[model samples]
Each structure stands twice: as C-alpha cells, then as structure tokens.
Target: MASPALPGREPGAGPRVEDLVQEVKRLRAEVEQLRVESAQLQRAVASHAVVDQAIGVLVMTAKINPEDGFMVLREISQHTNTKLSLIAEQIIKHAQDAALPETILAELHAALARRR
Candidate 1:
C-alpha cells in the first residue's frame, strides 16, 4: 500500500524539522560537555604547573634533585594528610613570603633529611 507524505514534507525530502531539532539539541549538549571537560583540563594544567614550580623551589632550597624534591613533597602531604597540590602552593608561598606554618616547616625539614 502506498502512504501519503507528511503535510509539508515531500516523499523524498530531507529529514523532518523534528529530527533536525533533536540533532541540534544533541550537538548543543555535546558542546556543553566539552566546555566542562576543557575547564577541568585547564585547572589540572595550572595545578601541575604549581607543583612543578614547588619542586624546583625544593630543588634549590633543600639542595635535592627534582625527583627527591617530589618525594619530599609527597611525604609531607602523606604525613600531614594534605593534598599534594595544596602543599605545593604553600611551598611556593613560603618561598615568596618567607612564611609557612611551623608544622609544615618541620615536616619539610624531616622529609628533606630523610632524602639525604
């Protein structure tokens, strides 16, 4: 049996308006998801940079190699139950302001000593 075409659509015409609308909606959602992912990646990159800078500071101030510097930071983070990125930020701040909590300073000294 032959069927009649939709009201305004020809038998062989392209997709209906509803299908196009759904596709546009899907594309919009994908774009939003991509935007969120990009923001997360940007934050990760910035945090990584801060950690690297802190490692460099440790390398110079603690007179340790970069690898050892990272271990010292990890040790401090574990012992203090703090995030590694926050530890890194504090280290950088101390380098700039000559101010750091006594607990952190003690842990840093201990960690550096253990590496020697």
Candidate 2:
C-alpha cells in the first residue's frame, strides 16, 4: 500500500539515525495520546453506568423522570463536595452488586442531589 509520503521512499527514508529516532518519538506520542483517550473513554463509561443505575433507582423509588434523576445526582454531588464521577461510581458498584439496601440508595440519592 502506498503511504502519503513519497511513492518510492519509505515512511522514514532518511539515512540518519536521528530520523529514525524522530519517527519513534512521533509514534510514542501517538501511543500516549491513544492511551489517554482510552482512559477518558473508560471514565466516561463508568460515569454512564453510575448515572444509569441511579436513574433506575430514582424512577423506581421516587417515580421521577430520567432528567430529574440526573439533576438530583448532580445536586447531591455538588452539596457533598465530591466529584460527580466518584459519586456515580459508588452508586454503580452498589447497584451492580445487587446488595444495595433501600435505605442506602435513598440516602445516597438524597446526598448526591443536594449539591445542585
């Protein structure tokens, strides 16, 4: 396959070792960027999981809409002086374990919702 570089020339066609080193550095930068993006995606997924579970709990216990449930979580996080993502992770893990007690869920929801 032809690369965007010169047709006959290799990607790093230069004879100097510095060129090869530069290519390696460039590739390393790309790899690092990909790693950072992957980590961000993981955090996003975790946040979504927490929000989804909290919403479900709210809908079941408080008969609230999804928007209201999210707003409540945002509020609680703000009031508790904690990160929203952290709060979400706690809620998600508890819900996933299937051992979350009703009292705890209610308290957590209330705590998270008060921030906003």
Candidate 3:
C-alpha cells in the first residue's frame, strides 16, 4: 500500500524530515539574530538620549551652540579615554544637581576652549 501523504503535502513531494529540521534551525538562528540586533538598537537609542541631554547642558551652561556642544563632549571623551556615551551619562547625572565634578568641569571648559 502507498504511504499516506504528510499533512498539507503531496505524497512523496514534501520536504524530508532532515530538511524540516534544518529549516527550523535556520529560523531559530534568525530569531536569535533579530533579538541581538534589537538589544543593540535599544542601547544605541538610550546612549543617544544621554548624549543629547549632555549636549543640552553644555548649550545651557557653556553658552555654546549644539554643534559645538557635541564637539566639546567628544573632545572631553577622547581626552579622558572614556566612551562618549559614558561621559554624557556622567554629565547628565551631575547636571541634575546643578554642579559637575571639578575635574570634569575643568576638562569640559578646556575642551570647549580648544579649536576642534
């Protein structure tokens, strides 16, 4: 007797079991990749927000334009061997208290004073 066809497949025409397993593996890998990509995107957005807040503080406190504000933040980040986002996060945290740490304030002033 002829074997019955698998559900939704013609007799002898559907993917083999191994092929289905491989397809499931491929789909799982894709889902994992998407998860990693999503996490990276979320971190990037959070970092961008901190950086923007730092820029705003620079603009308000240093009387600098937004472009120069970002430049100053970048320069300070470079000088301190810190990530720009970290520097920005620190700035935002301190600014909420209406003061920055003395060293950071000094570095910020110097960075702003320098020509890019």
Q: List TM-score per model, in order.
A: 0.85, 0.63, 0.85
What are the clash counts of all predictions, listed in order?
0, 11, 0
How much lDDT does each candidate structure score?
A: 0.92, 0.69, 0.87
Candidate 2, residues 47-80, lDDT tens digits: the string is 7887788777766666777787777667657766
Ranking the candidates on lDDT from highest down gives: 1, 3, 2
Model 3 poorest ten-residue lDDT run: 96-105
Model 1 per-residue lDDT tens digits across residues 5-105: 88797875778678999999999999999999999999999999999999999999888999999999999999999999999999999999868888889
The total number of steric clashes, by the backbone 3 Å criterion, in model 1 comes to: 0
Ranking by TM-score: 3, 1, 2
**Clash pairs, model 1 backbone:** none
What TM-score would you give candidate 3 relative to the actual structure? 0.85
Task: Give stretches of model 1 more than 4 Å off.
Answer: 1-9
Better of 2 and 3 by lDDT: 3
**Residue 99 deviation, candidate 2, in Å?**
11
* Model 1 local distance difference test score: 0.92
TM-score of structure candidate 2: 0.63
Segments of candidate 2 deviating more than 4 angstroms: 1-15, 89-116
